[model samples]
Target: MLRADPCATILSPRTSLKEALERLDALMNRLVEADQTGAGIDPLRVAGELGQIRQLLAEAPAVVRAKDGQKHFRCEACGTISHGDRQPERCPTCGGRKFFAADIEQPFVESGAG
Candidate 1:
């Protein structure tokens, strides 16, 4: 059996920033507990995920606006995000229509709110 992709699960459009942050907190707790028990921590994977999560949090609203419910086109070849009712048949730069759509959930520190 193949394991599911963590990023795929995390990139759900229904995911919320608040919930993402909460899950990050839980991961941190798990890391700490694992450290306490000397079970070894996967620092590289954790660091990579942290970076991706940070970027997602930073681009959350834009991601939603760009490709949440629509078939917006993002050029994997040129890294351009375009919003529309359909995916373009080709990216102007690379003329490639193959691309992946993922709902990005960004994480950020909430300030000035109780």
Candidate 2:
């Protein structure tokens, strides 16, 4: 028996991300069913699926964005932070050459209520 393409129904005028997820889930089930039917799987289809999943994850929204304020460059040695567009040539505190762009920006906050 030929397996039906679950993705055939995924195409529409207003296909949302949620709909795509549902279609992908159905396709996975179909692929699993096809595997148990004693037929060799299509390598190209599997490769395409892997690529799709990678792209989906890459585009997914990050959960840590709420906590992380912004992105800034931080010094590796003295732990000094710089909000410039690029890392400084030398650290002001320790004068170190090593620097990295921190995924999270934690600027010093003063609490005046105390």
Candidate 3:
């Protein structure tokens, strides 16, 4: 049986986590439906996929890394996130240099007017 590639479609940069999970949920439903109706779907494979999706849902947000292997940083003052070879010297939004240094939270969606 052919299954969707989670990494390519669901985890790809162009896809949002919320959207990916919804798509996976739809697939899981189909598998379960097949299982209940005796549609020749393997029960073990169905269980495995259910477990895998559950595990992924339980995991924390993945850390973003730079192309040069540096950890990403962000400004706590104005919530300005940065990704580069090195830490940014100043926040592009407010011109404030201080950053999270070690702890930063990058939101999936940015709020407030620019």
Measured on C-alpha atoms, candidate 2 has an lDDT of 0.58
Kindly list the per-residue Cα lDDT of model 2 for residues 38-79, writing each as its tens digit: 755676776666566556644543322224354455566555
What is the C-alpha lDDT profile of model 3 across 1-114, one tens digit per residue?
775533233243344344446657676677676679776665565566556565654453445454456666666555456666677888787787876643334535353659
Q: Write candidate 1's Cα lDDT for 1-114 as tens digits.
A: 453323333444455554556556666776777789786656776776577667656655545433345644556554556566777777766677875554344434455678
- Give the higher-TM-score candidate: 1 or 3: 1
- How far residue 82's Cα lies from its native spot in candidate 3, in Å, is 20
Q: After superposition, which runs of candidate 1 have C-alpha atoms over 4 Å from their true positions?
A: 1-14, 60-114
Of candidate 3, the 10-residue stretch with the lowest lDDT total is 5-14
lDDT accuracy of residue 73 in candidate 3: 62
Cα RMSD, each candidate? 12.3, 16.9, 14.6
Which clashing pairs does model 2 show? none
The lDDT per prediction is 0.58, 0.58, 0.57
Clash number by candidate, in order: 3, 0, 0
TM-score of candidate 3 on Cα atoms, chains taken together: 0.32
TM-score of each: 0.40, 0.41, 0.32
